[model samples]
Target chain A: MIEVLNPTAGPATGKIMMAERTGTLDGLRLGVIWNGRPYGDRVINSVIDLLRQKYSFESVTFRKKPFIGNVAPASIRDEIVESCDAVITGIGD
Target chain B: MVDRLTADRISVENLDAAMELYFERGWTDGLPVVPPTEMKVMEFLDYAGLEPGRPLGDVPERDRVITAEHLAINAVMAGCKKEYMPVLVASVEAICHPDFRFNHMATLGSAWPMLIVNGPMGRDLGFNSGMYLLSSAGNRPSSTVARAISLLFWNCTESRPDGIQRGQFGNPGRGHYCIAENEETSWDPLHVMLGFDREQSTVTAVSTYPGPYQVYCQRTANPELMLDSMADAISTYDFYRGTYILLVPPHFAELFIQRGWSKHDVRRYLMDNCKRSVADLKRRGLWGLHSSEYDGFAGVAQAVQPGDEDRYAYVFKPHEYDRIMFDDTTLLRRSDIYVVVGGGNAGPRLCFLAPYGVSTDPMTVAVHPV
Candidate 1:
């Protein structure tokens, strides 16, 4: 029997897993991070507005990464973590 | 006995069944992969003196760590000879270099990583350095090496055409594009210019979007006239571009050499001449006015300048706007103009344009032969 070797490097994993869902979208502040894409701000803001209409949110914090192509700087990431209960990072193009 | 492999094993009835299974699992690049049996993989790792668990590189954004075994398996599947393992290993290391920006190549642009081989091993390994450098004509090592890189990107990064690979019009070069410098010609090889010794065999990996754009200058023997032709070829690009490579063949290099100009001189000339005005750049839709309408445009805009919203294009003084805009601003400073000599040594002078933003840096890694 011929045995084929696996080529993939395996799936991605991170030390810090995403916060578990609290099963409630009420009174939680949401963070919106724009990745410098064109519609990223508009699309994310629209999502926030939709969320606002459905649930009562304490506040919505907006943060944009300083540059594109590379990962967001630590300061920006840290600010998001410290200020908001949950975050939606816009990560396209 | 060979080192025991730790990769998950799947017993197949035969080679044909293995190929079918790999296809079904989406492991292949829509092409048949040679069954990467345990024997072949072990042999491949042994040829390169690489441990199966050796970490070649990691794509942190994608959360994937590519190992020696991962590349060896794909290299074997790509039909590479056992001896070709070293080159593949080096290439994997090169692309995963923080500067190489392998992740960005998988984005919406038609960018594919092009490999440029240098030194004696290029000829020793039988890679084509002359005419049709991009084609797979009777050259197994060159073509298979390139194909193996694509498979690595696919299997490791998970950037498939239907997935993360968002090229608007992905070119065929995505599969394979490898060429060597024509050493026979009396011109400076690319590695030498990059400060590497001429004798060392190195593989320089770069991201070229939409393959190479060949610029032809047949009648013009004058250096100024010839460079003007080349400048005109790249001037019309609306997006702010950077890190373009000019593959100047022997004949063209001869003209510059006769004029007592070195590769530095050619880069200086192009950096001075190849330019577009700020008004022209703005007209190319580089301004943020309506950039968000397209998904691809949005990403490029964001990556161009992440947090700064107003200053979308390169900031030029009012007077500077009228003057030509070099991607690196004051030219010849950054790794902007990369010159390599190749082709039939005659015919229309060909140059390749590899565009990367200010955020990414290109790299050259020496292929350590066993």
Candidate 2:
């Protein structure tokens, strides 16, 4: 019998814990972060508009990442964290 | 060896059966891999003087910390020799360099890591810097080192097509794409030009696009004429403004080097000439301001009509794939061209390619072998 080692990085740690959902958007502020993907802003703006019609939003803030393919800067992320109840970012090619 | 190893080991019937097990586990680059037996991995780690838990680097966004154990295991599976370990390790670490912005590997599925090895190590180890440079051509170091990095991309970095890797067409370059620089041209080697000692071996890993498309200039002995051909190819339409890399074969290198044209001259000349007329771009349907970056044409929107060739092309939107800059578009920024010499000894052919989805640009990491 031949013995072999598992070649993968093993189970990923990213999805190990799920974030707590606010559960309702009736009075939540929406945070939109666009990573410079094509048409992502339009899609997110449409979603925000739909949410506005379906439920009351305290406010909506939009932020563009400094560059695509890199992490959002702390300043942008901090503002979103402090000013919004929830945040959404997207990836597009 | 088994007791010392921390990775989980699976028992299989034989080498053939081990291949099947790995295939079933989704751990290969769609090719048969050598069974990463405990002894094999142990030897690789030992030769590299690495402890199993040593952290090579990590993809912070993915929360994946690539360690020595994983690299050693993957290297063995890719059929790499112990001597190739240091180059391979340095390559993974280079891409994992936080600025490497590896996520593009997923989003731009058409991309793969292309390793450009520099210095004496590659030459001493027999990595091909000559004919059929990117092909295996019976060159073990060239083929296996490239494959090892590719497997790491697939197995460790999660560059699998089924997951996040989104390249519409599976790029064959992803299979194995690597080449050593032919420093014999007597011009400064790429490493020295990038500020490394001639003695220091280094590896630069680039997130490559679809091709190392051949650029031919066989007709002329005039360096300017040859460069004009290369510049034309570089100006061809593409989705993003990518940094360009040229692989100059020996015959092509002799044309300029013999005439005392330094690498700087090549870079400046290409920067000045690697442009296409707006008329040509429009005829090809590659000209437009579809990006938000061009929302107002930076106040010169009037200068751009159907085919003006007015302003030098620049600025692009993130989402728009085809629509590009206006005016006579200069494809390469002054510092955007990276020229490295190495290819077959006789071809008038050269390779013109570029990196895609870049942030901080490609990193050249020094290799430290044990």
Candidate 3:
């Protein structure tokens, strides 16, 4: 009999934990973080601008990462979580 | 005699059917596998002295725990001899290292792992360190071991081409890339340069942009003149500014070796010469309003406030200020420059250029013999 080992990661058992939903976005502060990729900040800023047009935001703050091709540092994450109601981070280029 | 594997068994009428079954299951790199039978994988595990479920390393980014059995299966499938298991195991450990940044293996760029074997064991395993070092003709063991890693990345971490490994311009090196440092040619073996003992055998892994930019230096043997040519290639506008591996063939490296120059000297020279002008970067559209402080223009962006037509006009101290140096990425500090010797005596031709980035540096792990 021939047997082959299973190389795939075992079944993906971790559940996706979603954040609590807030019904309204009115007057909530939003944080924007860009990972230093080209044009990521512009895209995020445009997104926050669009959000401002629809709902009134108490404040909007932005943070730029020091490097690219890396995960955000814990210190940055802490700052964003402490100051903003919702944070948006992404890659544009 | 080898015992049959205890993992789940699939009864196939013949080897051909087994190959087809594996292909259909997407358990391959779109290449013909060796139809890893029970005996082949068992022998590989035994050669490495590893238990079937021993955890080799984990790619937490992909939620994958690479185990001994998983590697053995892929090694057997990639046509690796049982004796090559220890090197294969060490290679798996190197790539899974957090410093290697296992997550970047899935990036939508031409980044892929380049494996370099160093020390005595490299020759014992028949790894090619001469002409066509990265090619199949130099060494089957090197190529097969590299191919096995590629297979593991695809099967274990789910980095298939059209899947997570989104290489915009896919390369042939993505399939297999491994080389043995030409230990005899260099002042020091790569492992020793990386802090391992002279006798120790190790594998160095780097997630790099695919394919090497070959540099040809025919009759000119002057160290400075040849290095000037290499520095120009290193500063090629298309080359990313980061850790670059220069595979200097024996004859080419001999130019400096004859002059009694050390590897450190080569690195310092390259660091001094491999730089781009700030104005060149701006002209290439790389200086778009980013917040990061560039080499010459520190805080110049904040100084040049918004809504100013001549924003950069005052930024230059003089017209010569535009000629100041800069790097594309800050991760590769001046000290991060690395060099190694390899390639056959096939002329004075070799290659060098930038790999992925500095976020993921070259990782080295010793290979322990069973």
**Which candidate leads the pack in TM-score?**
2
Error of 2 at B60 (Å): 2.3
lDDT per residue as tens, model 1, B236-308: 5533445677888887788888888888888877776665544444445454332333334322333333333
The DockQ figures for the candidates are: 0.52, 0.59, 0.38
TM-score of each: 0.85, 0.91, 0.85
Clashing pairs in 2: A38-B319, B109-B167, B110-B167, B310-B327
Best by lDDT: 2
Tell me the deviation in Å of residue B180 in model 2.
Answer: 0.7
Query: Per-residue lDDT tens digits of candidate 1, residues A1-93?
Result: 688877877767574366788678788877788876555788888888888889988888897764556677799888878887877775674
lDDT per residue for candidate 2 within B41-92, as digits (tens), equals 9899999999888999877666678889888898898888988889988888
Model 2 residue B230 distance off true place after TM-score fit, in angstroms: 0.9
Which regions in candidate 1 have their CA more than 4 angstroms from the true location? Answer: A14-16, A22-26, A54-59, B1-3, B278-335
Give residue B127's error in model 1 in angstroms: 2.2
DockQ of 1: 0.52
Candidate order (DockQ): 2, 1, 3
Clashing pairs in 3: B130-B343, B130-B344, B131-B344
Which is superior by lDDT, 1 or 2?
A: 2
